[model samples]
Target: MPKDVYVDQDECTSCGQCADNLPEVFAMDDDDLAYVVDGGNTAAGEDAIQEEIDQCPGECIHWKE
Candidate 1:
């Protein structure tokens, strides 16, 4: 199964990189913080998502356990 992804809102910096890079899986909320879209295509694969996580300025994105 694919690993699930999420954003730690408390740690989010509202950078918008994840949304900018992967709109299909991430988006900015009304608060301008990044959030994982519901029913997002996690099948976009781990490497792609991990790249965003690695590049995120806030480092708020993570894989769910």
Candidate 2:
């Protein structure tokens, strides 16, 4: 439903951009890495999540549709 959400840990700088943009979908862990919240809740905020992915400074976010 939401395609495939992917985060490239190698390029991620833990900037929190994704989480900031889409708190409903993304969150920062103790490691400061951004991750999508699970439990089959990913597709609910598709547009906002996609916007966050596009805004990621490190180019680490992707949606494979």
The candidate that achieves the highest TM-score relative to the unseen native structure: 1
By summed lDDT, the worst window of 10 consecutive residues in model 2 runs over 39-48
Model 1 C-alpha lDDT versus the unseen true structure: 0.88
**Per-model lDDT:** 0.88, 0.74
Candidate with best lDDT = 1
Off by over 4 Å in 2: 40-43
Q: How far is candidate 2 from the true structure (C-alpha RMSD, Å)?
A: 2.1
lDDT of 1 at 13: 93
User: 1-65 in candidate 1: lDDT tens per residue?
Assistant: 88899999999998888888889899999999988898764647789999998999887899998
For model 1, the superposed segments whose C-alpha errors exceed 4 Å read 41-43
